[model samples]
Target: MTTASWLAIAMATIVSAALAQEGQTQSEEIEELEEIVVSASRIELKASEVGSAVTVITAEEIERRGDRYVSDILRDVPGLAVNRTGSFGAFTQIRIRGAEANQTLVVIDGVEVNNPAAGSEFDFGSLLVDNIERIEVLRGSQSALWGSDAIGGVINIITKKGQKGFRGFASASAGSFATHDLNAGFSGGGERYRFAFDASRFSTNGISHADEDDGNPENDGHTISQGNVSFGVTPIENLDIDFTGRYTRSFLETDGSIFNVSSLTDLDNDATVYQRYGRANVAYDLFGGAWSHRASVAVSDVDSKNRSNNATSFTSEGDKLKLDYETTYRFETESIPDAEHAATLLLEHEKDTIQTSSMANEVDIKTNSIAGEYNLSLFDDLHLSLSGRFDDSDNFEDEMTYRVTAAYNLRETGTRFHSSYGTGVKNPSLTELFGFTGTFVGNPDLEPEKSKSWDFGVEQGFFEDRLVVDLTYFNSRVTNLITGSGNTAVNLSGTSPAQGIEVSADAEVLDNLNLIASYTYTNAETADGTEQVRRPRHIASLNVNYRFLEDRANVNLGIDYNGDQKDTRFSPTFARSIVGLDSYTLVNVNATYDIHENVQLFARGENLLNEDYEEVFGYGTPGVSGFAGVRVDF
Candidate 1:
């Protein structure tokens, strides 16, 4: 059935169930379940209290999805679009609220990991989901809290910490295309110290990245190896320290196309990438726990090499170092019961350098930032937040950005009204500022892109919070957007505007059954009112999960739909040109059976419908693939 039909049926059922349960005892339902988030305000705040649109993916939900890459889990999020070049380990891009791929900032354990040599974007394909505890996606402009490369939003991935007791898990899976994945992890802790470690290796002999009809029958393959280690210690009564390190190495088969265009497919090519990230933090509490101070240092390194069949190679390398410090003070007032106030101050400095064999000279940038935020609660039902940031960059002009947000809760109706307005900024990437000599040239006069954005959303609870519905409308106007000129980089004169509406409904229909549905409508246009490339007008998803057999077995079924949009393909008569890519639907299923307290058997099938679709022109996507695996824990 079509996505609309499924939505209709689900809506009808929800309405009917709400009406039926209206006369029942409302007290029978357990309410007061609140999620705490740290991404919105840089401090722990209840999800309902934050005056922004946020989504949290818990580890439980991650495990239930049975996904190998982080991109798979993010695909189901609303107001976001994910596109992959070809197969696993290939280039991946995630756009939020119709923003450019480089506009979003991705953070792992308080470290920014965007590649400086590239377009200041992080590739999600090489990120594995082995030791993640939760992911907080704060949608919309976040420059007031973060620095550059946050014009769209921020994604914060929190890794798992050691618990009180010993725990570990190991899993192995094999699937179509001769895919193999092995992962293991262990964590344990005591009152004073704790440690966690994880490792994973994945390899796939995959399909051709180009269309098989292109006369290149050679299959492209990929391999990835990753490791993570973390340790924490509390030596004093009010002092805590932690250190984390993560490494990833990937080798991929690629088609020899400089711009990844359709007509330049070549099979005899390969590439390798290595990424390393490390962080250390020290936190202390003072004044009887009324004030908290933290200091952290982080480092990121990325090296990539591409080798062609003709025995030619090109290499690029990027390195970054950052130091940050923050302090927050909390105040309480007896005049307004249950109301509190918090004020925070932050300071940061970063240096990034990029070097490429193809460029005659290397490029480096340095930035210093100072920011502050204030959060206030009034009458225990209203929340107000104000924040501002100032940044000084060596490669660009100084920038100042600010934001204001408000959220109110209606206790009687179980509803929340939230709104936020913010400004964001993004600096030009190293490649845009200093391009390769013979291939592309750079324009030093380019200005940093800036955006003004706002979002208004309402959340309501029905049937005693068993069913929840959310609707949000957001708009963004970006100025000085960078676009490619004739072998050079230039900023556009006019502004680009994007507006969208997001709708989501989640219901716990029964004690053992759950349903989730979401839809997004976006109107993305250029300065002259032209449709943007590769951005769909509509996207929808529906998911259902059920548990049976004495709660020992569980199953999940998901449906996803993508609307038609614009793409570029090579035309025999016209050479390379723009074209319309067709819309398609996909269905997926995952099942798990618990054999013992420490063991489980699982299986998953992707693209069960085997729908033929192209996210990017001339790129191949998987079809009707299945995998089975066993997991053990102790």
Candidate 2:
């Protein structure tokens, strides 16, 4: 027994003879394994008993999927890859798998909203899927309990707690070029305390390619406004307190074509930016059954002013401060149900200030960590784990990362087996130090990108688990992947080879239908072999939802596929591929209606295959869209 334990004993003897001939029953294509998560092993279990690879989006699936930011509800995640270059507060990137969208990691209730002033990155348009209630996506490398950007995984944005009685909601939307949107929120509680508030506004108009809407066509569009407030208190229930605040004011303007002579006659720069964000949390339950504790603090203020009607000008104003504290412990003395033990102690501090006409980059960072994890489910379904992390940073210094995961549970024939091994590191973003302006130039000796990853998977649940099937094979090498060099000024950290393969399927097969399919195949290369710029190497997605009338009306459908990338540049003055971005497929539709007992009505349609794609080549995304809304609960 060695060959992965004889392929896990021949896949647990063909899943225990297919679960003794499908014991659970009913099968159209099984699918119903939805509650179990311990934040990747802070200990909770049940995203199929977690080996790793999890995705959960709830809140009634964000109200039947009519998105309002959060990168348009992640376009139905699966090895995600979202790139919305402009429209809705401009500049967006949510790369995963092939990594590099600031190395994925965004937490909300647990604090850490990235962006330590100059691209620590966390901009899913500053999140707001209407006071979200649940969203947990932990694909891999949770840095052994979340530390140092969780390296290509971890997206926990949980909000909305306080529903034992009072509630409220509102929504509005419009379509076509002059898109418009409005959102509203309310939450409540008693017995101790509870509160929530939300607000939003969005608008877009810029894309008139046929006749070229030029009067000022630097791409013509954008305006966004947002507000949020959340507060909760138990004061004593073993102590619990929370606070969240958000404000975003965007009036972004863009059209910098100093001279490409085609993007609407080389329009000159037009830019303005402003943002403010805040967070706070406290929870303590030590001495209780499963010891626990938490403390968090965060802040971000960015005001950017850039103008160039002719005389070139760019102003910079910044601020970011974060402090986080963590403590968690799970128990079982006289234990051994397959034993369980977990611990996490972390401390983090960061600061950044950048004032630049051309350089005023500053940084101060601090990190302290302690990680210990142990699990043994050996015979009940087999599970083994190990974890490690130690980091210290002031711009970069002490570092260490380690991980291992194992899981097996052929539960006599329903299948489940997983594997993982990891390591990752990345630091270096104050705009890579001086905020590389205009023609791209800034590299204060940049360097900070490291990696090593591995994953092997197999999951099948033909019926009992409800038609779930997943297959994964991943690999990574990465090593100083940042690149820059307009012309010999130095700093072009290369070397990469991030391989990938992830396939997914989730079927509920009739009971009001629900099917989700996924696929991702990447091969980001670059160490002298090029082909990794603007990243993209095939990503596919399909989602279907059904529930009509009796379920109070519901319907959702989706499809997205993107492939075709390469826009390298060493500087032929600013290369532009042979003009990449060719593969395109988009179609989206959503519907909801409950009509009473609180009020509900919804409609959404996007792209509907109005086919026109360009995640970033000549920039223009957002076509054939429509929206209608009505929501209220109290």
Candidate 3:
């Protein structure tokens, strides 16, 4: 039988099976608040109880999608825009709520991974799906808890942990453009000690980063290898210690620069990048579990080298170290017998250093922070949270930020109402304050950017909690906006404002079918009414998934639509010009079927429609492509 026929039959069988238990399942609807989350509050709390806009991508979803890069998975998220220069291993940038790429904080296993030498922007291209367990995208100003580079939001990646019994998996795939992916991992644990290790290698004879029409015909290729290792120990009950380490190396052929702007013209340049991250954490419980304390130390390092056939070479390196301590206490009061109060205190210190080949000396920056949070739960239906942070740094002025949030659950109506207001501050990046000459001159007297943001949202659940609708409105105003004008970096006197609305829905419309849809509208511009470059005003996505054969087979189809936007193009003759980039749509599909208890076959088709699009002007994008693979578990 054909693959389509087989899928139909399998789906029918699973649907029948699901129908048999539908009555019972519908009667026992679980509360949405029971979904555990950590990033929204820096502590464990139910999703419905948190007042922030957050999206969680669990490992199960990651595996089902079979994404090659983290950006591929993040594209479907609401209130975020992901852009890439071209095919595999290209530079990827994600803007949250229309914030600049450098304003978002990226945390991998509790370590900040932003490159200090690159304006504190973390390249999404460097991150691969190897040993990740979950990803939390928390939207809005998080500087109240995470310090600088958090004016936009935070992307927290949590890696996998060892299981109780020994388990391992291996997977391999090959596709168009001479692409290949190989991955393997194993995890095991005893009563006291546990360990997990994973490794992956991906390579593609990629398309040129620059458009062929832009006089770039030579093909650009990329190769990357990554590994992760984690260990944990439980010395005694209520006490745990953990350590995680990760490394990635990438080499790619890139086009030359136009007007000193990389990835614009074909120059036959080669670039290599290396990233390393390590973190250690310890947690303890005291006073009969009423009080909890945790401590952590983390370090991240990044190095990059670029060379051209013209006998020119450049190197840049960044290193950072972080220390953190936190304590939480829970108590009850007689005045509110049904209420509980939890208070947390946090202290953090960080040191960052950056060096470049042309720089005479390395730049070092230090920052320290103290923060506190108070949460109150009344009658298990209303929640209130307040947090504040104070930061002291040597590079910019000192600042204090705070956040206040409230959430209420209407059990009878199955609705949740939430609202939040917060303040954010971003210090000048090392490259903006003390960068090398020739490329762009740094402004030592630049002031820090400050922001005030607020958001209100409502979530409604229906059909025995099988369907959920969410809507949120957010707004932010940032002063001391920083931009580069003709090789000179300066802060604009006017403010930058971003306002947006997000709407999303999740539905299990059928016994074995699921649907997810989202839409976002963003108006991001300068105070003087200038539209931001490459910030799309409208974006939407729809995803459908079906499972069959008693959950042994499944298929997922996704469509994403990106709206038109403005971009800047550079050329020696034209100097610089503003251009309008047309909007485009992309469709992707993936499927998997179990052949044996421990083995499965999978296939994927990307850009099925082959629509030509450009996230950045003069950059090439991938066309329709297909891949098939097998995975084995033991």
Measured by TM-score, the strongest candidate is 1
| lDDT tens per residue, model 2, 36-152 | 675777657766557777778878777776767777677567677787654555677787777777788777665566665446777675455767778887765567667666677
Q: After superposition, how far is residue 618 of candidate 1 from its true place, in Å?
A: 0.7
Q: TM-score of each candidate?
A: 0.96, 0.32, 0.94
RMSD of each: 2.2, 24.7, 4.8
- Give a tens-digit lDDT track for model 3, residues 1-634: 3222333344445444554456455666544446787887856888878998889988988887878788988988999888887767888999999889999999998889999988889999767877789999989998997888989999999999897889999999999889999999999999999999999998989888888766677788999999999999999999999999999999988875655454467777888999999999999999997899999999999999988984548889999999999999989999877898889999999998999887888998899999999999999989899999999998766789999888899989999998889999988888888875457777898899888999999998766667677899999999998888677678889789999998877767676787777788899998898888878998878777889999999999988888888888776654567789988888899999999999999999999999888998888988899999999999
| Over 4 Å off, model 2 | 1-73, 78-89, 93-119, 122-307, 310-312, 315-355, 358-361, 364-377, 384-466, 469-505, 508-514, 517-586, 589-606, 609-621, 625-634
Error in Å for residue 479 of model 2: 34
Cα distance off (Å), candidate 1, residue 103:
0.2
**Which residue pairs come into collision in candidate 1?**
none
Ten-residue stretch with the least lDDT total in model 2: 1-10
Task: Answer with 1 or 2, whichever has the higher lDDT.
Answer: 1
The Cα local distance difference test for each model comes to: 0.87, 0.68, 0.86
Compose the digit string of candidate 1's lDDT tens values, residues 1-634.
5465566477658655754565364457565668999999967899878998888989988887787889878877888888888877789999899999899999998889999988789999799888899999888899999888988899899999897889999999999999999999999999999999999999998877875556556678999999999999999999999999989999999884544444547568888999999999999999987899999999999999888884658889988899999999999989879889999999999998999998867789999999999999998799999999999999888999999999999989989999999999999888888884456787888899999999999999877777788999999999999977667889988999999998888877776777888888888888989788777878888877889999889999888888887876655443446689888888889999999978999999999999888888877788899999999998
Superposed Cα deviation of residue 166, candidate 1 (Å) = 0.7
